[model samples]
Target: MHRGVREFIRWVEAHRDDAEIQLNPPATTSDIAALEQMLGGPIPADLRFVLTRFNGGVLPAGELLPAGIEPGTIGHTVREYAEAVGGDFLDTELLLPFHKTPEGSLLAFDRSAGPVSDTWPVVDYYQDLDEHRLMYRTFDGWCRVCVAEWTSDDFGADFTLETYLRSGQRHAEVEPDVATAHATVAHALKRSGRPADSLAAYLQAARCVPPLPWCDWEALKIAAILDDEASAREAATRLASYAPAARWAQRETSPGRVAEVLGPIVRRSGDPKPLLRLLEQLKAQADEEEGPVVEAILEALHAGKDLPPVRPLREQSVVPHVPDVDAWWEASQAAYAEGRLRDDDLLLDPDMVRLGRLRPFAELLHIRRGF
Candidate 1:
């Protein structure tokens, strides 16, 4: 195998037990030949090298398509896409599919680049937009980017205040215009009990050109928490007065959600009149789905009943934990490593694969076989 591909294999193997890193066994010589025959072209040298050592599987960046003309294989998918779109973009000679985005868009090698396959650039084909854009100049370049993404400090890990801080700093430095990143940091800070810092971050997000409404929404919540009447009024005015054309604004600045967040604050102040008036103004722009929710909030206010607590952004996990799955996973992995448990054996044990740590592998297999 090529040295770079070998190093990637090593890194993946090191993380084999991780639920996120699913990889398949290497392809045989015949498998490579079959894929080449199906495509009627040579596979790029670097990609071919990697496939011989580790036939495509799920990666942190996306699903790497395995080689073959079989269902779910790279060649088969390329042909299928070409037929659907009626374009030369997915033509086997013009481009070769290698990966699929999380949304199922194809990323392929641009064979039109040159005679040499290894120098072919990678293009991200947006299925929805019917557009393709060059992403990387070479297969190795794409691989390096994927590796860097996975190796990043917070990759595949739950967010922590420290991670959020690091991410906030990086996003503020690298992509200062992205309001969502700033808002993420603000949320993390708010959750960590740093209202002042959180408010600052939210303000920064709101300062972005064409600012996101959610930033202002968050600022209002923080201002209410701090009892900063002026700041609260400013944020509330922004949320209630401005009209946003984007579809996302409907959900982001939903009056019902805003009311819930401000419920306790208004109750504490012994005045629901101001908030009720604000919601009434926002109700004009609320969609069908949101109008009812806002109406419910208004009814509760009129009845002098305490509003429910703010619903969390993400629902808490309700999946029951399996008993000693950790210990079973260790033993299962050990058995597999010793060849006591084959891939076929693991496949048959659907519960173990689905409920246990082998979920990633099962998903990969399902994709590969088009199950």
Candidate 2:
């Protein structure tokens, strides 16, 4: 019932059916209480206000957090946080991710601001950079800012296609920072269901930004969402310069995931060679669960390629006729070297060939992903 939350919710309801707006059904009071119980605290009044009004909805601004914080929700408000409640990332028990900035930072609540029934201050948590900073005094203030950002002259003057196109017609007279403004415009266009324009705007934004991998990834995503092969290939080709393997090794990234996204686009719109090369390099560096992710990608990339049959590990071995311990010392060095040759190639030998995740990518593979 907070005025700010109430206002935003009303605005959302009024526009929810608009092709350009996005939103979900509101949650019940009981559902809110249940979530709070799971979260081991009282839900803040304003935060609850959003959830109650829209179980989770997409506004022209951005998608809202559902009661469960599923993939498409506002922030990285994962259900996993409930169990990892006291972990390093979830450092503050009272904080909960509520929204995401266009640039991908998360806006979470400083639940410690006051009691559950009271207002909670908002904090900006940079998901990629692992940085945190104060953003607004309260959720109410944040919503006002967001609403203003949508229609305010400073932010493209409008969130609709007509306004954006009109403003673009006078590009020199409006939107000083062409790249960032276009990117912002792209989001609005996307929400409005004009995906083709959104993709173009995203491409423009990608070009404006530095050769950053994330932006390229986002561009690729936008293109894939629109099912535009050429744009996806454009993003993929850019993504190659920054080696996926090197990047994955240095940071928390998922080449396998990227492959899953790009595979289909490549299949339809472009060549998968560059993407396959990127995946191969990353697979060389990837291990464990990512192994399967890479495997899945490889399978998708070259589903028709004949693969080596699965090899069994630790199977019962037949003892070959040998000189026995008498010649052990004499043959040990040679035998061990030979055994090394027989064993799995620990070296990144392209042809050393034992079935690791990627069976030595032969062809450029393709994959497709929805936005």
Candidate 3:
């Protein structure tokens, strides 16, 4: 494998935890060969490197690839293609389908050019028309294309801003403060150098998630860049409210944030009395329920060990509140206190979630819509 490709794989591994991209693990060399052999074509060097590393997964390429054609691993993709279009597809030098387009067409590379050129041209093959149309001169070129707008038509591009922006917008509407979806839009706009537009997005993010340190921080920076003194001051004030949420924020979150939240004043006072008082208060709160989790938190505090923090902004989530949400919470808590429930019971409980105070460790659960 090329050193550059290896470096890219390392980057992918580092970022696979990001929620936006659906990255699969790297493919074994033998797995890559099987996929290539299944397609009856030697994969191009750049394309091969990416496929081997990512094994085809949805990337942060906004709008270019529609949600319909989710990138699948080479092995799964080829198997599906074969099952869909029998043995004859292997012989065609017409289109090498890599992505399934939202419009029910196949986005592929024109294999006919592969033999002559070091890099093959990309094409969109419409099976209904039995024709393939050139889209880009090379796979490398397609990979580098930056989508500036959104459209439903087949004007031609691998990534589109439409789907990505729409998804973020939907998430922001639902879980704004919890998940920081608006921040995704803001960050993308920043990267595209649309500072004015990015500032607008950051403002929306600040509104949706007022306590987000990054939103205020980014807004503060962007406002200053735009020379908007009023906006910068407003952002700085909001950032101050979040104070120490961002203090230990590395990338997204860390255990230190929890310590900071619980022990900040106690550590400064130099009084064990206050610390004990705080622990007594927490214990009183925990009196409603006590499991291994609360015990661990108390023990960690006493031993000067780190406790977990609140859910990371990007990973925080919430659910719809039915009228019965309160009732369900009460019942679940009682069940837990009585040892009538397991972790799975709380996890599967409709009222219990990572955002709200359902249990002692509710704040630390992975952010998702219902467990």
Candidate 4:
């Protein structure tokens, strides 16, 4: 185990009783086994250890602790309550935990929702809930949490929710340049009401940095609306270069738009080479089984009479072919006797010369061609 993981484990054990409110010692091994079967994987190691320690009893039951109390406030130890919750805590980006009511309702405290009772259950037994509105985390990261409304062997109504802890926080602290650029572009776009010409300019400015999702399409749509053919072409080409999978360029109808927007540029440019190259890339990508936008590119390429040959590339190898095992063995023995073979080389053609059975070069030569 890593040093950090070990230290965290020690801290969790020290505060197990206090940090986990409504604590109860875990059920027997059989019960745990059953829960594991239900969850489809082993419960995380740290979480397993915590449940084992607190399963049978409650510590601070019926009282909600403040945000960050469970993990951040437990102790100064690097691991503490945070580590005890296991990888899931970090993966989910949990800002706070929901308190389950006696009536089996789930509630969370959102300052954005305005003043409500201290206990605010998000879902009530009588009210229908929006599954997409319920946020949850996964082992990979915060994703739409899919909860099954009805359990079947195959499929169920899975719920998705937002990650409460915002993304890009670490980037802001660690990569100030990138964060600043993104913030600047975002602010500009917001203030400008997303004008097409302004968006095109911003796209050029932000091309070297990581993109915000859907930013390219927003720029492209703006360019098209403004009827700036050159700007639209630039936006399309850039979008194709950076993210061919983006939905705007991926639609089957997208090629018509690309050709309409970029056709004039293709005609007027000194050389058709750049346009041809872009067409080839789009065509090659379209041939793949994935991405609808590739198909759109294919349509555009065909429309422009710019499609390139789609034949696969072939390369030649130097190794000669031997017809059968007997011929291969005789050739191999001659090569070994001539000191042309090494242990590694012999291993490469095991059928011709088994590694252990092959004699040393000198002995093999003495026995063979009279060395």
* Maximum-lDDT candidate: 1
10 residues in a row with least lDDT, candidate 4: 141-150
User: How many angstroms is residue 231 displaced in model 3 relative to the true structure, after the best TM-score fit?
Assistant: 49
Q: TM-score of the candidate numbered 3?
A: 0.33
Q: Which one wins by lDDT: 1 or 3?
A: 1
lDDT for 76 (candidate 4):
15
Order of the predicted models by TM-score, top scorer first: 1, 2, 3, 4
Which stretches of model 4 miss by more than 4 angstroms?
Answer: 1-68, 71-87, 90-197, 224-234, 242-261, 264-272, 287-371
lDDT of 2 by residue, 289-310 (tens): 5667667656766875533232
Taken over the whole model, the C-alpha lDDT of each candidate is: 0.64, 0.53, 0.48, 0.36
Which sequence of candidate numbers ranks them by lDDT, best first?
Answer: 1, 2, 3, 4
Deviation from native of the Cα of residue 132 in model 3, angstroms: 2.9
lDDT of 3 by residue, 313-334 (tens): 2322223334675665565445
Angstrom error at residue 309, model 4? 24
Q: Which candidate would rank higher by TM-score, 1 or 3?
A: 1
Per-residue accuracy of model 4 over 64-121 as CA lDDT, tens digit each: 2111212321111112322443433322222223233333332322212323222221
Off by over 4 Å in 3: 1-15, 62-87, 92-94, 102-104, 114-117, 127-130, 146-371
lDDT of 4 at 123: 21
Better of 1 and 4 by TM-score: 1
